[model samples]
Target: MSNQHFLTLQDIAPQDLDALIDRAITLKAAHRAGEASPQFPGSVMAMIFAKSSTRTRVSFEAGMAQMGGHAMFLSPGDTQLGRGEPIEDSARVISSMVDIVMIRTFGHDIVERFAANSSVPVINALTDDFHPCQLLADMQTYREHRGSIRGKTVCWLGDGNNMCHSYINAARQFDFKLHIACPEGFEPRADLLENNSDRVRVFHEAQSAVEGCSLLVTDVWASMGQEEEQARRAAAMAPFQLNATLLAAAEPDALYMHCLPAHRGEEISAELMDSPATIIWDEAENRLHAQKALIEYLLKTA
Candidate 1:
């Protein structure tokens, strides 16, 4: 095993990714059966958040406790990094004191620099450029409900933000076809799309992208830091909302997912979010199991 950093879905090999998902499933079952493993007894995970969170913070903190490890939360106000400390300096200091580090921040380069200087494994909890951890949970939930995502067509029907970029990575790593539908200015990073052109396609109409797709997904119309643009985004993205009509165009058994903290009636309608086709709750819960598996993999591998 070699030291590694999970900055993106592309960080791990296809086989390892598959194995991690399987491990997450097994761990989830064990958890339900009241069998907790002390895989990282006495270890510590330092969680640094420049960006605020609910799922990322809770899931990682709770997962660590369940695994017999402790997780320390460091907010921007509490850490010098927020007060102008270089990312490399902060990474060196924090990683030395913890067994693993998880960072949820703005720039992708922040995590990159931290990982470059860290002594322990680094996990990208989230970033403006990619949210790989969420992708793990999404994949696990899909596998649990459907099956292998390979060869399946997945439609992303909202802001081409971090989640969208991670989905593009997922499509390539998991061997699936990704149909991304976002408003013109909201399209995912051009370099990312070009890198996985064979596996991903972009569209301006949600209906067209969802057609024949086995999985349909979306995110909030305006993500964090884009709050002021909510009204404008809502108008621009109105045509791309995931509603009953749009969902109807997808495969009959198609599953709908949202990374959540969802804005009902914005990116997706409330009725549609509550529909039987939606597996968002399961996707949310998988975050715990998937991340536990990830922590175990990183620690053990390291």
Candidate 2:
């Protein structure tokens, strides 16, 4: 939590990272039990989003507000950075005014620069390469329903995007067996594959990926700005859909997960998302709790 940056999962030590996760779980339970307080009184968080979002925006804003902190939204076109101000300058300026800075942007380097120059804690809301916050909520969800993440099997059935990258990173720190099922061209990055190959088990087949798995996860087949290829992506990812047949291949109690704003019949079936085993609402609710813990962890260090 020290040294002033949250550039990537690699920035956090494994043990400390686990401690944060444990804290998140505890915080989530406390909040649900109506025992948690708005600990961030009079604090402020600034959100710089070069990319658009619905859940990320609402979750962070509402989470901070619930913790007695206010969030200021700054979109790319609405800010001076869009007019050619150096990112470092914007980072330094924002750090001076806020208790914490959250950024959802295009490249990883943009977030890295912000964290590097900022004095306050830098939180990655999302980026082209990693989605640490989302993963935090995800880990909390697993802990809630599944008891423990260690020694469990997590099956990812979609493109190896930022979410998949963070999941693989988490797998390395925790003891979960990860099974990634992506189409040939849609596989996770090679370097990520190599780094976590020893820690996780990868699969090209959805059946093999979900077999005996404790959890099944997926994301949008086509992410934002990739709308041009929606048809192509849908075609490529159709066979991997989370329908009843595929869900049956996993553990009988296997839970379903998706980073929200799911395409109803595209990536997951409506029935599965509304099923008894679905914990997505819990997952969605935990986004607030997980971020509250993350903010507390970083602010405590300060």
For lDDT, the strongest prediction is 1
The CA lDDT of each predicted structure is 0.92, 0.85
Backbone collision tally, model 2: 0
lDDT of 1: 0.92
lDDT of 1 by residue, 1-302 (tens): 23599999999999999999999999999999999788789999999998989999999999999999999999989889879998889988888899999999999999999999999999999999999999999999999999999999999998889999999999989999999998899899999989999989999877788998999998998889999999999999999988889888999988889898998888889998887766899899999999999999999988
* Cα lDDT of model 2 by residue, 1-302, tens digit: 24456666666787877788888888777777888478889999998888888888898898888788899999879989999999999988888999999999988999888787888999888888899888888888888777778888888888889999988988887778899988889988889888788767667678877898888899999887789999999998888888788889999988889988898899999888778867888888888878888888888887
Q: How far is candidate 1 from the true structure (C-alpha RMSD, Å)?
A: 1.3
Q: How well does each candidate superpose onto the true structure, as a TM-score?
A: 0.98, 0.95
Q: List ranges where model 1 is wrong by over 4 Å.
A: none
RMSD from true fold, candidate 2: 1.7
Per-prediction RMSD in angstroms? 1.3, 1.7
